[model samples]
Structures are given as C-alpha cells and as structure tokens.
Target chain A: MSEASKSARPDGSNRPAVQLRSAVALLGSFPALAGVDLDVHHNDVALLQGPNGAGKTTLLRLCAGLIGPSSGTAMVLGQDVGSANGRRRVRRSVGLMGHSTALYDDLTVEQNVQFWAAASKAESETVVPALDRTGLAGRLQTVKVSALSAGQRRRTALAVLLCRRPSLWLLDEPHAGLDKDGRELVNGLVLEAKDAGATILIASHDLDWATSVATRRIDVVGGRVVEGTVVEDAVVKGTVVKDADA
Target chain B: MLSDARLIAAKDLRIEASSRVLLTQVLPFGLMVLLLFGFGISPDRQVLGEVPRRSVLEQVSPGLFWITVLFAALLGLGRSFSIEAADGNLDGLRLGGLDPAGIFLGKAAAVIVQLAVLEVIVGVGAILLFGVSLANVGLLAVTIVGATVAIGCAGTLYATLAAGQRVRETLVPLLVLPVLAPVLLGATQATEAALFGPVSDGWPWAGLLGAFALLYIAIGIVAFGSFLEES
Candidate 1:
C-alpha cells in the first residue's frame, strides 16, 4: 500500500466523508446549479469546473456554510449544512481557501495564522502542525504576508487553513500564483489530506491537475452543471486530462 | 442568538476604537453652537445678567443641545457603514457567519462611544462658553448619555439603510432627522431640565428619549437582516 493509503485509516478502516443531494442555486430566479447532486467519499478528490458566472463560487460557498441554496438542500457528513446547527458543524469541520488570501498584511505569517486560529477558537497546540503541514516551517517565525512573494503569501494563507484541518476542504482556484514546486507541494497536501479522511473539492480551469488529482469531476456553465467522461491522454511529463473530449 | 450579536459587534468595535478620539473632538464644534446661543438669546450682557444663569440655561439649552447633537452625530453617522463597504469588507464579514443585527449593534456602539466622549467635551465647553453651571452634574451626565444613545442607534440604522445609495451621505440625515425629531425634542429638553432645574423636571422628556432609543433598537434588529435584498 502507498504511504498515503496507509494514512487513510490511521487505525486501518475506511469510511465515507461527504455527500450532497440535489443541490440547486438560482440566478435570475432560475436554476443555476440545475438540481446538481454529488458525493466525495473518503479519500476522493473531486474537481468542479464551470464557465464564468456559472455558480461555481456559489456552490462552493453554499457547501462552506457561507451561503444557503434557494431550493434544494445539501448535506455534509449526513448533516444539513444550511441549518444553524448544521452550518456550525460544517464550518468547524471544513477549511475553505479562495482567491483571497484572507491574511492580514501587517501581521507576521505566524501571527496571522494564530489570529485566525484564535478567531475560529481552534486548539492552540494544533498551530505548529498546521504550519508545518503547509510547508511553512521556515517562514513561521517571521515574515509579514505583504513582505512575501505572491506564492509565499498563498502558502501563509494555506498555513492559516491548516490551523484547522477540516474534514472537508473546499478550495476555489487553489492553484493560482503557484510555481512548479509550489503547485506540486499543494497537490501533495491535498492528496495527503484526502488520505486522512479529508474529502477534497477543488474548482479549477486547469483540467490537467484537476484530472490528475481528482477521482470525480463536475462541469458547470452558466450555473448549470454538465457531466463529462474522464479522458486519459499522455503528456510528456504528466497526464494530459481531456474533459472537452466527446 | 446574542452570541451572533457579540461576535459581529467585536469586529466593528476593534475598528472603531481607533477613531473614538477623532469622533469626540466634534464636541468643540457643538460647544461653538452652544456659544452661539449666548449671542442669539442675549445680544448684551445687561439683558443676559437680568435673568439668572440657571433660568437662561433652562430656556435656551434645550434647543441648543439638540442642534449641537444633530450636527455632531451627522459626522459619526456618515461613517457607520460606508467605511466597511468601501473594500467589500462588509460582504466578507457577512460571509463569516455574522448576523445583520450584529453589524447594526457594532455600528451603533461605535456611534455611542463617539457621542459619549463628545458629550463630555461639549458639556465642559457648554459650561465654559455660556457660563452655565451644572448644578445637578450627575443627572446632567445621565441625560447626555441617554441623548447620545438615542442619536447613535437612530443614526446607525439610517446610515446602514442608505449605505448602498449613490447619495448616501445626503440620504442618511434626511431619513434620520425626520423620524428622530421626537428624540431630539425629548433628549434636549431632558438635558435642559437636568443641567439647570430639578431632575423631576426632565423625567417626561427623558422617558420620551428612552422610548425612542428602544424603538430604534427594536426596529433595527428586525429589519437589518433584509438590508442586502433591498439595497
């Protein structure tokens, strides 16, 4: 078994993680999500794709407990994420990273992570593991976010995400501003988190990584989702994932 | 449920603490307004001295206090939401599980803090400028506190409602002043009675101000959640 598969069950057991049912969003009071349904079982990485203004962010936010769907309901770990209690349960168990770093520029990287940790009321002891997991060990002690390069700032923000290792990770455009090494490191972290029973839902336009990484893929356009068959095309260095394939 | 309120309020309070000093400085301007009352009420010292200082304050302070408070509160109300809205921070905060009323309380609290500090400065300035002594200082202080609370809640609610409009600055006072006239009349009258006459003299007006504040709090809580839909 790969090291990641072994870590999937720290004690050696498999279990499903997240499920969504008939989730729908309306733009112009019409279905944007279009009665979408999905599942991300334990260790399953899902890629969500969409054209511009296609309810991609809306779907992510709805799952993140940041928004409520107009009609259909959603469930994370068998709990409805839209209800008050369910939203709290989901927020505590999920870490969401988006285009915005959500970091305070003036605070040091460590201070920024700690403040978010404190705000979320996360355990103090978990801070270092979170920082180390994001590969920010060297920068943890010092370095203001504004002082860091674009990629480094994303790492710091990712470190903030690690402060609370949510069971479900929803990332919107997590690959932006990443160099080759940074992207690989982030992909590894996502894969590793999945192995640890953290189901991953990543939205991206770059189908190569999404296909290479995710077990399932969903496509959205104009707030409507269309399912595409997985295609495997070999690339020089990595897999060439083709979703537009007929 | 109030935890929702506290969590949202804490965010705005942290931001508002930085501006409390600047907001309070407007009291000097309010004091100038009070000093202007001296000129209007009595052009010459002979006429002013004929009436006892306490009587002169009782007759003039009510109108002057409201005018000064209205102008000073305009400065604070202008700030309440447009500051947060400038950078899309308001939507960010809403995304973080904060309730709308929580935002309302935080904005109102910032206004209240400013009013309290300004009241102290204006109170002292009013005394210095008009030669009016506060015989019942404790009661007068209470009245100042009440009036400011009325202004803060009333002002914040209006500011938020107008925040998205193109002419929000103009819209805020226009919406607030008409609805809040009773609060002004009550609070200013209460202040006059407290500063110059017996505490009993101000109870009716104080009661009126108290009711106004409560009404604003109630209305703000119920209506704030629907702000984005309307805006």
Candidate 2:
C-alpha cells in the first residue's frame, strides 16, 4: 500500500494544521453557516454541538474545503478554500467522516483500510495494525465489506481513517455506528491521533460522550455561531443549550 | 498530471485485479451475445450482410456492444460507490485527501479497461459469429477504444451521481444509454468500414469515435466533483 495524499507545503508543519476565518456557506439559497470565525491550535480537540441542519456538516465541509463558502473565505493554514489548489491542500490535511458512513461496502475490511491509507499518504506499516486495533485482525483476507455488521464496518472505517495520520480531523457524528467498546476504541484513536500532533474537531449529538472527550465546545444554531465558548469545566446541560429557533 | 493520472490508473487496475472473475464473466457474456447475433442473422445473412456493413453497423453495432458492456459494467460500478457509502468509506476517502478527480479516474479507468477487455472478446466473437472480416486491425482497435472510453466515462458519471438515490439501479442506465447513442452509432459505423473494406474512401471514422471519447473524459473530469455534492 502507498502513502495517503497530504498537503506538503514547505510551511505545512510550521504552524497549526488548520485555521478558519469568517467562513460563510449557503445551501439552497439559505445560509447553512455564516460568520464562523475561529482558530484551532495544533493537537487541540474541540467539540462542536448543534442540532440537525444547524450548519455542523456545512462548517465541517467548509473547513475541509469539500465545498466553497457562499461569500466569505475559509483558510487552512492561511490558504483559501475557493481555489482548486487551496481545496486540495485543505483536503489533504483534513480527515472528515460524518453520518454518510464513508466506507465502501464492496471491498473487504483490509482493502477498505488500505485504500484510504494510500489516498491520505499514510505510512503503509500501520495498515495491518490499524485493522487489528479495530478488532478486525484475522478477517482481513476473506471478508467482503458488505458482509460485515454495522459496528464491524465502522470499526474497519475507523481503522482506515487512523492510518491516514492527517494533520487535522473533521468528524461529523463520529459515534454513529459504534458500540460501547467501539466508542472507547474511537476515543483511543482520537487521543492517539491528537498525540501525533493532529487537531480534532468533532460535531456530534451525543453531548455527554462528546463533552467528556473534548477540551472545549462551540455551539452552532440555525447557521450561526451562537456560542463559541471554550468551556473550561462545563457539563453538558449547564453549558450547552439547544436553540429554541432550531 | 501524468503522475496523478498514473497513480489513479494503477489503483483502478489493482481493484479490477482483486475482484473475482470480472473478465471471466465478460468474455462468456460476449460469446453469448455473439451466439445470439449469429442465430438472429443466420436466418437472413444475405439480407443483413450484403446491405453494406455501414448501415448494419450504424444501427445495431453500438447498441449491441454497449448493451453487452453495460451489462458487464453494471455489475461493478455500483459496488465502487457502494463500497464508500458503506461504513462511511466515502468520508474516509474525503478525509484521507483522495482528489475526487483522481478517485473518479481511478474508478473509471478500471471500468474502461474492463470494458476494453470485454470489447475485444466481443469483437472476436462478432468476427467468428457474424462473419465480419477485419481488413484493418488498427482502425478496429481505435474504434473500440473510442466507444469503450465514452461508455466508461459516462457510465462512471451516472453511477457516481446515482450513488445514494432510491432508484439508482434503473436510473443509471436510463441516463447513460440515451447520451451514449452517438458513440454507439459512431463506433459501429467505424468498425464496419474497418471490417468490410472501405465505405467512405480514406476518411477513417475512428477520428469521430476518438473525439467522442475525449469529450466524455473531459465531462467526467469536470462534472465528477459536482456529483459528490448530491444530497
């Protein structure tokens, strides 16, 4: 397996992996996310909590450079997302997984991991181990991806994401298909990724699980950043509130 | 661009290799189609064969070849997208930084290469079964390449576009086959001339086929990124 495709600007590793300015993105002529200004330092694990269609996915997509903003610009390491080259670089650095369950069901567990590892430019040495870490060790050779159960498939997908060694991680609803043990496995993976100098930003509805895992929280409601607080020691109910308008 | 293209191509070829019996089924299916063509035309070879290969090729060859290739292709294209849609693999690739174009190229290359192999098999079957004689191997090869390239590009595009829809199975072919009519006509006509001696002097119908291939490739590259945004 080859390495994944990460951005290799000479100054890529000089500063933090991701930085965002006033990013505005509209979906269906309505603002999906607007006035999103923030900065994330290297290896910082920040949680984004919001309801469905609260611009969580849009913001993540903006930060990942998967789509362009409606008006304002989003910069990854100070490069614009609107340009093709900028978007490529941002995509290389950022690893995003959401409700879409991005794994390919037709491939086997190992092939699934290897494909992403090759794309993200990750080291090949980690491929087998990532599979093993996700509790998919011996099943590599014969298991077709479609045959695996939901949690098992998510485990394999996680294994693939871990192999990439991305500088920035953008996760939307990361805990979707994981069991309790699987969630712990995800937490370990996130911690391990962070330890490797990767910044983590997760958008999830499971507040207790998310708050426990994150050091700070940003609340988005109806396409606006209503609360961008760095909750030092805040609990889920006290610090986080769903927008009535949402 | 070449390095990126080569990388994608390699991945695509690797995927086709890893899959079980992809080409095996193709050759057999082509042979069966050849048998069907033989049975259909045997009753009236004089009626079908003597009327100039151009007319026969124009009306039936492209559709027949595409029908054969499309049936073979449909087996794997959905699997390509379905693989990603499963367990969030698309997100993994997105997060892993695979360029959507590179990814599409890789997947499309696999389909194109597979279709080419199948086309060769079908061509051989057609020759044996339909009694079509190829006077120019080069022209025939070029024509096949053009048709298959067009089919592959357009097929990959629709497959990606229909990745998550309710009626993806029926919708893809409905979208692709209509747009593919020109390539089918062009390929069939060019192949006929290459087989049954020259019909249009030295114009060489392969050029039209090649142009059509290039056009579809450009469309695939440009529009592929847009399909990823489909809800």
Candidate 3:
C-alpha cells in the first residue's frame, strides 16, 4: 500500500467511517442541511442524489470537515466534525472534489498535482502516475490549467485527488464537466478507491451514472433525506425505514 | 505546520514567478506613487529651495514611502487570496491536512517577499526622485522589515476575512487600511528618524512596529481557521 493510505484509522474500529445524527448546518438564514442522519461505513460507495439547493454539497462539505454542523452530531473517522481540532484530524485522511477544481490556474498540471501532494503529505513519487491515471500524462509538464478546457480541468482535479490517496472521498458533482471518457474515468476511479478500502460519498444529478456503481442510493430533497429511500445494492426495490429514535 | 507553510509559500512564489504580475503591475504602481508624490510636492519648490532639495525631500520621504507601501501591498495581498479562490484551492488547502495557521503564515510570507521587493524598488525611487539621503541604513532596514511583516500579516488576515465575497476588492482595503493606521504612523515616524535624525531616536517607534507585527501575526495564526472556514 502507498504511504498515503497510512492515514486510515489505524485502530481498526468497527464503527462506520461517517455517522451523522440529526446533523443541521446553516448558511445565513437558510438551513442547507436541516437535519441529516447518515452512516457510511468504510468501503461503502454511497451515492447522494438530490436536486438543486438540496444540501448535497453542504453534506459533503460537512463530512469533509470543511463546515461544521449548527446542531447535533456529525462524525468522520470517529472524530467530531463540528470542532476545529476534530476537523483538522480528519482532514488529512479525507479528499474532497467539489464544484470548483481546486487547482492553481497559473501553475502547470504537474506543479498543481505536486503542490497538492506536498500539502497532502503524499509521496512525491505518486504524482506522475496519478496524472497518468487521469489521462493527463501528456499535459503534465506543459499545460497551465488556465489554458485547459473545463473537462481537462476536471481531469486535472481528479489527478490531484488521486495523488492524495485519501481514505474517504467526499465528491460533489464529480462528473459535472467531464466527457464520456472522463465520466468513465471517474467511475473507474471511484471503484478503484473503494477497492482500496476507501469510503466514497458522491453527490451527482446524473442518477443513472451514479447508481451504476453505488452500493447504496440516498435520496435527498428539501435539505432532508427522504424516509425509507436509502436502498442497498442488488437493485433492491424496497425502502428500509430508519429508527425514529435514532 | 511549518512544512505546510513552506509548501504553500513555495507554491505562491512560483505562481508569482510565472505571472510576473507583482513585478509588472504592483512594482510599477509603487514607483508611480513615488513620482506622483514628487509632482505633488513640487509646488513647495520656492520654500524648499531655501534648504537643499535633498533636505526638503528628506523631510517628506518617510510619509510618501509608507503611503506607497500601504497601497501597493494591498494589490499583492488581494491577488494572493484571489489565487486561492481560483480553484477553491483555499478549501483544498484546508482539506489537504494543512492547518489554518500554516496557510496564514505561508501566504503572509509570500506577501512579505513581494512587499519587500516593492519596498526596495520604492525605496530606491524615493531616494533618487525625492533627493533624500539615507542617514541610518541599519534602522531603515529594520523598520522596513518590521513594517512589511505587520502589513503582510494583517493584510493576509483581512484578505481572507473578505474572501469569496463579491465586493472583496473594495472591502479588503477598507477593512485593512483602517486597522493598519497604527502601522502607517509607526512606520512613517520611524523612517523619518532613520532619514534625518539619529538612528537611536527611531528605536522606540521601531519597537512599536515590531509589536504590531507580532500582534498581527498572532491574530492571523489564531483566527485564520475561523475566518477561512466561513465560506
């Protein structure tokens, strides 16, 4: 295993990597995440499907420790997500790909990845192959991100995430600007990360593509999870109601 | 934390090296300010001719030098944060295992480097254009270093405080300049003593600049996380 994987919880606790109990997050006057209760275990490929302004991005940001819950509990890697110190502890192990590419426009593709790798404390040796995996090998040393198309930018973002080798991937709209080949690449990357013992929570409007590889489907609307809509794999058509007391 | 700061600082410096925006835009802006001051004060030629032109320019160079630093430093600090906003790299940094204080230091250090360059160019422009002779080179150096740190640290803090906002460009200066008045006063007065009076006379003001620098650096390190996560 790569050195980046060493950030996984070393104690090997049986607890789910992510657990939210009535998690509420607010942006200004509106509640982005009204009250979300979710549990995603290690290696679980959970797909979050929601419409616009449905709190999908907020949930992912909360899980990534980029935002804190306004109320109730949200935990990642067994650390409280609402506290500053707790957020810092989980950040090293979690990789988030959001609506923005999170890249330096002035830096070349290679420098962008290497900078992130250094910041993520990943092995420098892993940078080039990560670029190759994302189909950015040719553009690696030559292209500035400002000169790339949106799809190419997305691929470069993926390459940076790949370098981190994070155990938990919180991806918001991971395939938004990608082409057919790029979409396939994202699916492959998700599966690859899962196979490597990573837990993935992806938010996407592309339900068909998202569910294709999802271990479970979580439907979110109006900033709340629809009751009994968390479906497991095997094309199950039933909704298992969660405990009211939970 | 230190390693993370170094990584971020290096990345910013590389970006500046590639774009040359600081050199091509901000540095020229500093020099323009120096020239404008010369023109603005040219009206005083009759009263100033009584003393040597150098002596007259020396009296006012301190204020003009600091004013140039203040405005030019703002351009660099705003650009520093805007680069992070480019790819949500700021959020990326937060999630990449770097603490907020590390980001603060890295960015401030980069700004300090840029401002130090600006200081040098502006300093030379002041000496030649304003006809001011250096009195205490050592004190001037110390004052510039201290004033640069204070501005860099405080400017970075305010830049991030206004990050991701639409009116950030307008807001950053309003938020930073008012807060930096003490720095401006201290730097101006310290530079005056370094230029005209004995170097020892400026030491207390230099101490004030040093204290301000330390205070802002501490505030940045303590508050960067909270301010950064706001977006």
- Local distance difference test scores for all models: 0.66, 0.67, 0.84
How displaced is residue A67 in candidate 1, in Å?
A: 2.8
> In candidate 3, which residue ranges exceed 4 Å CA deviation?
A1-12, A227-246, B43-58
Overlapping backbone residue pairs in candidate 2 total 22
Model 2 off-target regions past 4 Å? A1-22, A140-142, A229-246, B1-42, B45-95, B99-101, B124-138, B153-179, B199-203, B214-231
Query: How do the residues B1-231 of candidate 3 rate in per-residue lDDT, one tens digit apiece?
Result: 787788889999999999999989999989998898888786345434544344445577899899999999889988998898776877887888777899899999999999998898898888888877778888888899899999999999999978878788898899999999999999999998888776777999999999999999999999988888774
Ranking by TM-score: 3, 2, 1
Best candidate, lDDT? 3
DockQ (Cα-based) for each candidate: 0.15, 0.48, 0.81
The C-alpha local distance difference test score for the whole of candidate 3 amounts to 0.84
* Tens digits of lDDT, candidate 2, B63-181: 46556666666655665555445544454555555566776777778778777777777766665555556677777677777777877887788787777676777777777777777
lDDT of candidate 1 over B91-138, digit per residue (tens): 334434455676677668767876777777776666666666666666
Best by DockQ: 3
Global fold similarity of model 1 (TM-score)? 0.71
